[model samples]
Each structure stands twice: as C-alpha cells, then as structure tokens.
Target: MLDWSKATKYSGILQLYRNLIELRRNKQKNTRGLMGQNIRVFHTNDQTKVIAYHRWMEGGPGDDVIVVANFSTQSFDSYTIGFPNSGTWELRFNSDWKGYCEDFTNKGYSTTAHEGECDGLPCQGNVGLGPYSLIILSQ
Candidate 1:
C-alpha cells in the first residue's frame, strides 16, 4: 500500500494543480520569455516511444522561459525539471490554453503571472498536472 505521507502529498499536489488551472484562467502571460526569438517547443505524439524521444537543443539566458506538454492521452507517471535558482516562481502559462490573469486592471482576477516573484520555487508546495496541460513559470 502507498504510504500515508505519499497520499497527503498527492492531495497537496492536486490542490496546486487546481490553483494553477484557476490562476491560468485569471491571468495574462509573457510571450517568448527571454528567448522568444529562438523558442523551443516540447511535445509528444506517441506514448509508447516516449522512452526514446528525440532530444532538442537547450541553452539560454537562464532567464528564458520554458513550456511543456504531454501530447499523449495518458498522463505522466512522474517527471522532473531543472532551473537556475533566482527567486520565487509561478506558473504563468500552459500549452493547452491561453492565460490572461496578469491583466488585473481589466475585468479579470487583477493579478499577473509575469509579475509574480516567489522564493525561487513554486511555494515549496505540492504540484499536480492534468492531461495535455502545459506549464509555464516565471523568475
């Protein structure tokens, strides 16, 4: 049986995922990040061959932003990401949908994704990701 701690962790992750979804719906995002001119997109079409997926070029100003998608119908069992430490982080965009929450001045949540600055991490909190969902972050 799964450990009780893991179950709590999963629940916490789900909550964060939900917050991301809600935040995405309520904010606007920055386009292209620091490397919009040379943006790289990551996605998949085949689930079975994901183990041998093609690798793409990676190198940027460290302030550059990244976007990722699952592409497959099945959800990811687990995944990892690496980023340079700078400050608090927030998910501002997703591949599945457009974001507009940052434009709080408008008739929206009155919050901006690109304007957020956490403590170099996602609140050191749980994270959940849904199928075909995209994840965007800011420094």
Candidate 2:
C-alpha cells in the first residue's frame, strides 16, 4: 500500500495532483479549454519524443490552450513550436516544477508568438522543456 501520510505533506505528489486538477477544472480562471473537446495536434518530433497540441472551446484568446509533453530523458532549452495565432502565451503549468519534486529543474516558461511558420502554422514560439516533463500554456 501507498503511504498516505507522506503524500499529504506540503509540496508532495498529492499537492501536485490537486493543483493540476484544479487548473483543468477551473472555470473562473478560464482554463476550461482543457475540458473542451476541440483539439489539434500541431507538432510532433519522433527523435526528441515530443508532441504538442492545442485545445480550445470556441477558440480565441481566453479559450485557447496549448499543451506540450516531453517523453524523452533529454531536456531542451528552447523547443520551437507552432501557435494558431500571433500573441502571448502564458505558462500555466510545468510538471518539472520543484514544488512537485525537489529534484526537478523546473524548466518551462511563457512565450510570445512571432510571425513565423512552424509545423504548418503561421506563428511560432520557443519554450523550455524538462526531461520527461509536460507544460500547459494559455492565451
């Protein structure tokens, strides 16, 4: 059996789950895009073991969300990926945050979409990715 006592402590795995679950279900924070059905896979790199996708409810600034996951052990300082439109994207969640695990490097940040073509999209942005980590971004 798992040790519930240890998990209930601050900055433990349970807290991480609570944070993630709260964000995914938060309506007041405009994170409901994660709960929407619209999704589009925009980027995928087999060699790097990375994939990126966009999720939206009605699509637009407040309802759009981008998710990137790194499945490899290698981390990237800046991985270029596509965005549906040009603007700012906020880094809402990073799985590598030290709050979840003391050893995590916490590599991930917000990015601004520039006028460039990437993964067949008109706008592109660069973001950090930690080893075996995932990140969520929103407009």
Query: Number of the top candidate by lDDT?
Result: 2
Give the backbone clash total of model 1: 15
In model 2, the clashing pairs are: none
Local accuracy by lDDT, each model: 0.37, 0.88
Candidate 2 lDDT tens digits, 41-97: 989999999999999888887688899999999999999999987888998889988
Clashes of each: 15, 0
Model 2 misplacement above 4 A: 1-3
Give, for candidate 1, the lowest lDDT window spanning 10 residues: 103-112
Q: In candidate 1, what are the lDDT values of residues 1-139, reduced to their tens digit?
A: 6466665545644454675655434334332343334543332335422211111124322234544454444444334333333334455544333232221111111112232233342222212243545555544
Candidate 2, position 80, lDDT: 97
Give the C-alpha miss distance for residue 6 in model 2, angstroms.
Answer: 2.8
For model 1, what is the C-alpha lDDT against the true structure? 0.37
